[model samples]
Target: MSLDVVVEHSVSLGRLWSEDGLDIMIAPTSVVVADALITWNVNLQWVCDLDYVPDQERPLDLVAFAAPCLWRRRMIAALVAAGREHRVALSSHSVTALQAAIENGLGIGLLPPESVRTGSMRVLKTSAGVPEPLTVQYGLYAHDRRTPVVDAAIDVLLKDIPATPGP
Candidate 1:
């Protein structure tokens, strides 16, 4: 239940993260550790402060989440390979606290497509209009095909959150 940054980015070991080489990995996901799997058409809004605006009138900041799992770890590795890791901070803080911080101008946050809200935050345009998205293509894999919990978890994920397009 942690992030696996730099895992299998340079080369694939096809083993558990607990194995000799993969130990350095095993990072968990959050707004602090890794890049999120955004849509290819993701329109990132710059989460900033509304200092001059009234508190009661200020808009809510966007927030999103991703559970820690094997497929997610591979995604982090892919991000590292593409040189897009750490685009924003991901931490263990509560979502409300994180969103408030962003609303207070801590910095921009990359939210999932469904969480996007363009009220107060202004969109950031890449050189090509849309910024590149974090990789989200892998599923679960283990040192041995007979691994128990991993496959079951993967099965659950397969049914829970199917990867979708950005808003």
Candidate 2:
């Protein structure tokens, strides 16, 4: 038996899991389906680069994840609430690509702080005219079609993956 891991849009992951194309999926709670057995995970608070100050006078250039990624909606909604006009300067499915774009000063992105690699990247605070992003609930999902190997894999993952962040 072999194991494969894929990272993509949550909805695609959920669809694959429902079809048995994937044995397990770790995705946002919004994608959870009726057939899936879900274990509640952590809430991911998204932040942007510290230098990302929303300019109300101009259209905000955005670095974002491509479509089917539900998290992108949260970013857009937050921008709307802040009354900032926005345009997507760059979009990618890979977090790495998005991070690179942000680092290069292409545009502002609502990113997971954990994904920030460069020292130049700092957390943009709401005080800095940046909108406060919504916290997304993420979880591990599996279905009844699991094999013994799949079950064992799930056990190992649940045991290793922390349900909450460390202090």
Candidate 3:
């Protein structure tokens, strides 16, 4: 048996299903769930820098995903609801770039747990008056009718879920 994996932003992953080009996708529920079947989800932790303070005299600066990324939109909405303001100092579609920017102290960012560096950043908590970031509900999705290849792929991915980072 052979397996093919495609790494893409969530917006592009949503399009793969309609073209019949994808057998399975592991993505956030907000991105691709409407037509999927046999879905399983895990709650991932959303993390940010420990030293970054919110609601300072000035708007918080952010290093974030680009306009097409759902994380950016979600983070902005959550901050707004909490009566906090922010500016996007840097934006990119690449997770690696976001990590680098956050590490260099360009601005705070909402990052997947795995992308966070232990010494450089920490998970955001309520102490700073920052609203909790959106829940990271990522789902494993498959089409209604599964082929053997698709089934095997799902089995492998299910077995390979990464351990969440520790605080």
Candidate 4:
């Protein structure tokens, strides 16, 4: 029996193929309910620091993870699609670091709504336009030479993971 774990920005089961092996792949979806554009807080002082008036278009300094991360890629694509101009003020690999930057009032960043700590941050809906929400899908791959043990494990995993919602 062989087991392999892969962590990647994209899911590509075809690349994991091996000769004389059948691969069973499972991809779960909608792990994130919503992807929100967030800031430290929405208040008079914070608004004044931004030097912007309400209901107006303005370029914003943005915080994002380093390139090659899917979240960053999606955020950039959303910004371009919305026709909103932005500059990256900070970039880090750590989500905790990114959140700290946002808390320091560095710039706005994208995060799953559930990940946000209540009272420390606020969700912002752009008047210009909002980005499409993000969702996560997990993929599991296994070889076809199924031992009884492997089959049982696979069954448990399939039963444990939540099913994706249908359209």
TM-score of each: 0.36, 0.83, 0.80, 0.58
Give the number of the best model, judged by TM-score.
2
lDDT of 2 by residue, 107-167 (tens): 7787765677547676666665667756776777677667899898887877866565311
Off by over 4 Å in 4: 1-58, 136-138, 143-160, 165-167
Question: Model 3 over residues 5-104: C-alpha lDDT tens digits?
Answer: 8987788887886576788887776776454333443433345565655556778788888887777788888889888878899999888898888777
Worst lDDT window (10 residues) for model 3? 36-45
User: Which residue pairs clash within candidate 1?
Assistant: 2-27, 2-28, 3-27, 3-28, 31-89, 31-90, 32-89, 32-90, 32-91
Q: What are the per-residue Cα lDDT tens digits for candidate 1 across 34-134? A: 23232222232333344412122332222222334333344344435644433333432344554565565654444444543445444343331223544
Instruction: List, residue by residue over 37-144, the lDDT tens digit for candidate 4.
Output: 111211111111132232336666777878766567767777788777777889987778877777667777777654454456666655434455555444454554
Clashes of each: 9, 0, 0, 0
Q: Which stretches of candidate 3 lie over 4 Å from their true place?
A: 33-55, 162-167
Q: Candidate 4 clashing pairs?
A: none
Select the stronger candidate by lDDT from 1 and 3: 3
**Clash-forming residue pairs, model 3:** none
> After aligning candidate 2 to the native by TM-score, how far in Å is the CA of 31 from where it should be?
1.0
lDDT of each: 0.37, 0.71, 0.71, 0.53
Give the poorly placed runs of model 2, Cα more than 4 Å off: 35-53, 164-167
Model 2: residue 123 alpha-carbon error in angstroms: 0.9
